[model samples]
Target: MRARVHVLVKRALSVVLSLTLLATINFSAHITSAEAKTRKPTIAEINEAKKKEAEKKAAADKAKAQLNAASNQLKVLTAKAVAARNRYLQELKKLEIATKKAEIARKKEEAANKKSNAAQVAVVSSKNHIGKVAANAYIMGSGFTDFDSILHADGPQDLMDRLSTLDAVGENNSSILLRLKVAEESARLAKIEAEEARVEAVAARKEQADATARVAAAKKEADQARAAQEVEVKKLQQMQDKLIAELLSARKKRVTLEQQRQLAILEEALAARAEQTDVKAKVWPVNGIGFSKGRTTIRSTESIRTNAVAFAKKQVIARKPYVWGNEGPNSFDCSGLVYAAYRSAGLGYPEWDRVNSRIYYSWTKRIPLNELQPGDLLYYSYKADISTIHHITIYAGNGMMWEAHNTRKGLLYSSIYSIPGLIPFGGRV
Candidate 1:
């Protein structure tokens, strides 16, 4: 009975395993069917969606540009206002110096007037003293009767003393008068100088006051200008923010779709790997060449040689530096480099060089980045210049990209993140 039970258990386990296997197969088949139904979008759907997205992006870009222009204008106005304010302040400083000088001059003038009046009084007193000394000399001479007789009768010492006394008296009177005259002249000159200084100081003060008023007026104007500019900037910012939000929403939707597509592709790859018994060597569609090369060659040729050369060229230029306007030899501008490299290959590039040209419609729509093998076209947009695609690069796999950039750094390979404003679009050749 133990052996019978063991056999029964083994049978039950086998049945369970079989059922499990069958269920797994059925589930896998169902998944496969669902996947098949949800395959990549058809060309028409892609084109339509792309068109819609392009329209929305265009609108967003226009709004952004307007906002940027307004911002720039506001900056210019602000600078002007600042300059005006500085000029007014400078005038005010000059005015202040002038006012101080005027006050000093007035004080000096008052002092000079006082000195002049004292000097005048001294001059008058000196003249009166001289008159009194002359009268006394006359009276003394009269008392001597005859001047010659008195001279002869007197001793030589007496005559000498008399002459000496007369000389002393005359000298004292002359010295006092001379001193008084000098003082009076000095005072007069001082007064004149003081008055001139006072006038100059007054003028300076007036100028200073004017300057101060001007500065105040300028400040008021500057303030008004700043306020106006702020209002304009705020309005512009609002518009820009609204447009950016819309752009972000659209980008999010696109990202969602892209994620879904990537997930689906990953599922398919896993399924294929599971079913395959033998691992096959993975082959690149365009050997030795990259997406950039194909894009470059496609501009000039439709031949197979063009495609091959483009591929080789891209591989060779994959490590080139990026230059804003560089077209060859190690650097490149976005579209120019892309066109040049593809032209080297046999693939025909878009007829128009501009990003917004009608020829890009098909390319932008049907190509998804994950579906890109080799020789896919890459588009890049500048967030600053959203109206046009400013750059293009070839995908070099391994998270590397090659492009011709500005003059500063010619053709070069750069991480996508290194570019501040780059928005990427992947498309097939």
Candidate 2:
């Protein structure tokens, strides 16, 4: 009987030593994690939105550049239009002067033509008068002729008078012919000048028309360019607005991440629980598996062998990479790890994401922190309802939990307090 008692005492000492070692190691690791988090980060700020937003910024810049180019082209086209319009106005002025000059030349040409016609009539009448006089002289012979008159004259005075009369008539005819020739030359020159004026007026009108057409074409081009620039400006503004919206959302996510970081640094779960509650975490049944002061109901555990087997299974799968929706022996997500761990230990763990199972997992009975044992599931949420539960971590005891948090930090151990949000509840399989 004494030998049996000694064997029991040795067994108790071994158990106590093992628990003490586990607690010490857990405490040291928790402190170390806290210190690591507390170190002021010398690394640059990084986030999902940070890298993704660069593409948005690049596109915005390209749009802005295109908008500026469009604006410049519009300005150039507008200037060209203005120049064309000015040229049109100048050409119109020139055309008006040319048209007035052409009208004056035409009037001068008509006046000269009338004078030429009058001179032609006068010359014709003079020639006819001279011809009639010659015919009478020829018919009347010596009496009508100068020589006959002279021969019949009684004195020199009569002969001299006849000679003077004949010379005066010839001089009158010569004067009339010279005047007609001058009038004809003047009319011809005036007509030629009038034709040239008309040609010039036609050319001026053509120039004005061309200038006007150019102005119209330039104005149309300017209008189109201006419209395109306006569209680009609006698109640029919208891109800038989109970038601002993304920045706002990113700011919110960054703030949330910062808050979680602070909690991790300041509140180690085991230290927080010890300071806040009297019933500390342990596998003992007296006060560990019963009610706590905070009205927290700590449930009794199943066989130790079952929980130990699940925990061993989890340890074996530790460091496995996290995938989005995978739950396997190779890759696991947050809830996937939980499912595989408990299921490996012969527990009927749910086969869905923790968020989906939150509202309907009544089979995995609720337990408080005091009743938490290895292999139990820890759920975190920001609100009272089960819908708020967003993440799940498996309790690995010794103040640590196993999680497949994300792709970057795959399967790893973490303190319970470091998890974002409040501990909504715990589920035991």
Candidate 3:
């Protein structure tokens, strides 16, 4: 019984030492993580991204303004074109009236010339007939000679009277022939004047015809001009439509890019949060009094092992300076501290040798964070802008965590909110 009691006492002492060690290491780790999170990004990078986003939005707005201006201009142009077309139509109507007047003037002049020509022809024919009648009458009067009349007379006195009468008749025939010749000359002169009038009328008619043709040509040209204007108006309308479509497409593209960027940012924030929550749920194995190293412990009949390799690293890097790029002993980066902590928890540490790695696995799919059992790997990001597993802390239940961080603070206990930008993501060994 003495031997058994001694053995029990020794085991209890061992348990106490183990529990104290685990608690000390855990506390130190939390302090380190909290300190590392305090380090921040340079102001230049932040300002540059903000400026870029602002410039893009401003450009989009300017394009929208330009599009509106173009649409207004198009409307103005359309109105002007419509007014011009109406004016052209009015002018065309005037030209048509002028053309009709010119044609009527031409026809009247031609008819006057035709009537003058007919009058001249009739006068010429009358003169010719009068001359011929005078010649025939003169011939008949000459045939009645004075010698025959004297021979056939009964007495000398009767012969004398017959000669006197024959002489008077010859004189009358001569007078009639002279009058007929004069009348023929007058008729011929009238015919010549009529012909001259006819020629003048024909010239006037030709001038009128030429004027009518000119008016027709002018109207045709006006019509052609109106058609050309219509075509130009159509082309301008099509161009305006095309420009509007292009503007709309550009605006749509800009909106889509903005939405995509926002979604990406939100997704990144959620991913960081999930990783930290998983890290928080992880439990280190304790051997009755303290955490055990190099051995599996049973709690609630479930066997568990701390990440022995990670444990060794923490021991090696405790109190290391918080260097941005340092990975080991005398100095540590954010991810380095987290990596070391996980190893100490007896979980198989993934080979996240690079600062940027794609290690997205859902530990909660099998074991939810709300029902977090022991031995889960609670992950986190010190700089949320950094990769998902930039820094980590072990979750001790009740809103407490442990981490190893910068040499300035070493390992310590930390509340969840102690790290300024710490976000929780969860994983399992």
Whole-model Cα lDDT per candidate? 0.55, 0.58, 0.47
- Of models 1 and 3, which has the larger TM-score? 1
lDDT of 2 by residue, 193-255 (tens): 766766776776677677668767766776676677667767766876777676566665554
2 versus 3: better TM-score goes to: 2
Measured by lDDT, the strongest candidate is 2
Tell me the tens digit of each residue's lDDT in model 3 across 242-280: 555655665555544544454345334433453354332
Model 1 per-residue lDDT tens digits across residues 1-429: 234323533555676546534544443343233322224544455455566667778887887787788778778778878888788878867766776777778778888888898898898899889877767656866443236434655787877776676567768977998899898898989988997897777777777777678777877887887788789778878877877777777765664565445444644554444344111111111111122222322322235334633553453435566555545555555665655655566344445443431244234333433343344544544321224345566654323355555657665544322343232235545
State the displacement of the C-alpha of residue 228, model 3, in Å, after optimal TM-score superposition. Answer: 15
| Model 1 regions more than 4 Å off | 1-55, 89-171, 254-429
User: What overall lDDT, based on C-alpha atoms, would model 2 receive against the true structure?
Assistant: 0.58
By TM-score, the best candidate is 1
Ranking by TM-score: 1, 2, 3
Residue 240 CA displacement from its true place in model 1, Å: 1.2
Worst 10 residues of 1 by lDDT: 279-288
Of models 1 and 3, which has the larger lDDT?
1
